[model samples]
Target chain A: MARASVTRLTGRPLLSRRQDGLALRRAMPDRLLPALVAAMTFLAALALAGAVGASLLAQRWNNGAAAIMTIQVPDADAPAATGAGKRGDAVLAVLSHDPAFAAAIPVDRARLAALLAPWLGGAGGSGTGAPALSLPGVIQARLRPGVDPPADLAARLESAAPGTLAERNQPWTARLVALTRSLQACAALALLVVTGVAVAVVAAATRAGLAARRHSIEIVHGLGAGDGYIAGRFARRTTVLALSGGIIGTILSVPLLLLLCRLGAPFASGAALPPTLPDGDLAAYLSDALARVPLPLWIALPLLPPVSASIGWLTAQFTVRAWLRRLP
Target chain B: MIRLDEIALRYPGRDPNRGAVLQRISADIPSGGFRWVLGASGAGKSSLLRLLSLSLKPTSGQLEVLGVSVNRARRAALARLRRRTGTVFQDLRLLGELSVFDNVALRLRLDGLPEDRIELEVTEMLRFVGLGRKLDVRPHSLSGGEQQRVAVARAVVHRPPLLLADEPTGALDEKQAIRLISLFEELNQMGSTVLVATHNEALVRRFGHPALVLERGRLVSHG
Candidate 1:
């Protein structure tokens, strides 16, 4: 026959060496604190994930179009101010010769129509033989590193081709950086708040445990157990609870994080992932999905438990020690 | 030895007259001395024991237990002194969650005694108290008399130099109470200072030890 179980069916280890003198197991129940801590850890994980995601986004934007500048010439087919070629061709020649820019790519009418297809639906029309709206000639060129975008480059372009306008992308790049920094700051603040809340949760749970076991505590204390002994017991218990909570919270956050990374993968890569997945290969899909999360996050997720345990240990130690001052 | 000089205990409050528990009481007991603390229910016998056990700091006074000045001792020093003392409460404050053996072994364990030695000592003490078969039994499972014995066993298991019992056998029958007192006498013979507080004049007469008598928060008699 099964024993009439007084203790809840816990996965307590079969063999034990040390004894719990205070019987803190019954004094501090395992459920409420760990559950609350797990919730806090989950929020912390998300906050950290957000910070990491913002960093990756900043890197992507920095490496992407932020280094490129654009030059647009109106009335491109018209005569150039230089009296040598079409205005658009003149502007291209000047840009191509300049050491500051590289890989000057001229946008043709059909490509221009495709670019504008979202705004002007007629871009999808008739083979694009001279777009209905007379679009300016658009030229994109990568700005080489250490290349000072000459302040007078726009004037030079205007001289080569009348009405040519140079759009410096540097300000927008700085703005993007500032935006990402703001996002990272917000994520950092969220992380600090979450950690603060986790500490508070552990502290409150510890106080409750102390209150619930006042008699037991008084007995041990009266038996000559020092503040360190009593506080150490509470710290050990809370550390285990917080560590377990952190591990569980981190584990639970993984799939959700993976899904989020997968959804945001297109924004990072600047293109949609191909839908044609190979059939009947679950491992392949899982590996692919795992690859979506950043390597830094992989390293960081495993650290939450130890960090959480440290917080719990420190919080319980101080709280219990402070509370014991009321005893003697 | 224990020394007290004009010790007073009072609950801090606006009304001074209603708060004093033990007041202007001074006494001394040498090493290896045994004395019964005589008082009524509302008298301050328990509070005096609480002061000796280092669980309560007197509101104002001088107290020295086991040669450490209770008034000036650091908390850590007091804890060390407390480790050298043992107490058996009237309520038999056995940790309900622990078994009889563990309750008896708590002080030794806290002192970092070796497990094998602790087990041996706790087992012997339990047997001496006639609860040898109930080593693993919880305190609540025992009868009132048996529970008092457990408390007594725990108090003396470490052979503390200063043994203080606050109504130690208040719940025991005459046979059980006498047996418990004999245990204290045996410990006192073994060179421990044992102080038992009780209102039972019959028990006091049976033991015929010197007594410290209190009335209305004052030490009324000592012989």
Candidate 2:
């Protein structure tokens, strides 16, 4: 046995200070287990972000993109076969009157020409540079919730003009929704695995602590220390360590989360990406990206320390109590 | 006070024939009575003291310590019973990590004594054991006789109603042995039931107390 300093021992205020007689500071060290927990927390943070992001994306796509139905009326300026009004007018009247369609707005000619200018020459579509060629009219229609587009919509429009196509992106939107749901499920599974691994890590660490302090524990037990007293020493030590690990992991996840937010910025805000800058604008980008991390994630990330501490405390309590059962 | 009626302890996973270390042994010690546990090596003296101190549950039969039945008592009830008892092991099981003061204070701390009371009691006990100046020193820094006194101080610091000592004077000289026995005698006179196990017949004859002698895990005589 190495000799310890007498003066240091005497300097302690009372014998009550090291009430943890098992010397858990020496038995269960503060380093390795927290590091493992920190790694687990980091993965957990990523999984949480994925789950939240997938859910938000699904909701936005469902409400905005999925409900929109576009109907294109080509040769739009031609007279109606009913010979009463223009072909585009006939189609617009049918969509606006239908209760199944919530709203419809016809895209005017100038904006339509500018939109088609990319495929046709700019002068050919604009009447200013040359005689304007016939261009399809686009009407972005919104479908009412749980309502299907009438199958006869294109047929009714064709009565007015030979070819007017009603195109709905519903199939593609459905596929995207399915994809995001599975992504959320996968993220949820990852969270479960990380949580399990953390519990196991804490359990293994606690068992090792018990083994290291076996003789001291038995001696203390012989001194009439109850099972609660022994288990409390371990549980308190492990909880502090786990909390430290969770804090470290949360701090480490910040940069990663920020990067993911930046990558996802355009889709979330429905804003166009900024043209390339020399990163003098990086601070602005960073601030914007930080804001994009959901409120729920902000709330959830800070809670990791407490959550992990709870896990560590409960696991250590159960483990130590069960281990003490082997004693007399 | 202690009472044993056919108490037996069998540690499992040993040589099958030698496994039952103490078998159907019986004895009764009145309150404040002193007894010298006499046995040759492998004669189960330690095991008997172990049972008396509530360190081992008897494999079968009855043991009543401090008027509480050992086998039938709940774990918490047994713990409360154990706090009333103290034992000085042969190996001097002092926690090497703690100072002498802390070591002696451990029992009172377990009893939830107030901080000032624990300090006062531990200091007084260490001084009584003649280790007052070495209160802050670790057990390993003490000599063998000093360590033995420290163990004795810790065991009796709580002033338990029951005290058991096993080979307490094994490493002590004749004078030190007499001094240790005198301390036990004083504690016994103070109304503690003290039991000492020893292999020293000369010391036993010198002290001249009743002896419960054992041979091969069986009590041969009590005279």
Note the DockQ of each predicted structure. 0.44, 0.40
How large a fraction of the reference contact set does each model reproduce?
Answer: 0.52, 0.38
lDDT of 1 by residue, B48-155 (tens): 998899888899889999899988888788888888898998787888888787888787888998666666677778888889888778899999888988988888
**Residue-level lDDT tens digits of model 2 in B62-171:** 99998999888887888788788888988888898888888888899889887667777777788877898998888999999899988899889988889999988887
lDDT of 1 by residue, A22-113 (tens): 67787778888878888888888888888998888888777656778888999998988878889999999988998888668897767777
Query: How does candidate 1 score on lDDT?
Result: 0.84
What is candidate 2's lDDT per residue for A1-328, written digit by digit as tens? 1113332434455534445458898888989989999999999999999998888788778876788888888877778878878888888888899888999999877787777777776654574655456567889999998788888877776776778888887889889989999999999999999999999999999999999999889888888888888888899999999999999998999899987866775776576665443367877777777777887789889998899999999999999999988887
Off by over 4 Å in 2: A1-12, A15-19, A80-85, A97-102, A107-135, A144-168, A274-282, B174-179, B189-191, B202-209
Query: What Cα-based lDDT does every candidate model obtain?
Result: 0.84, 0.85
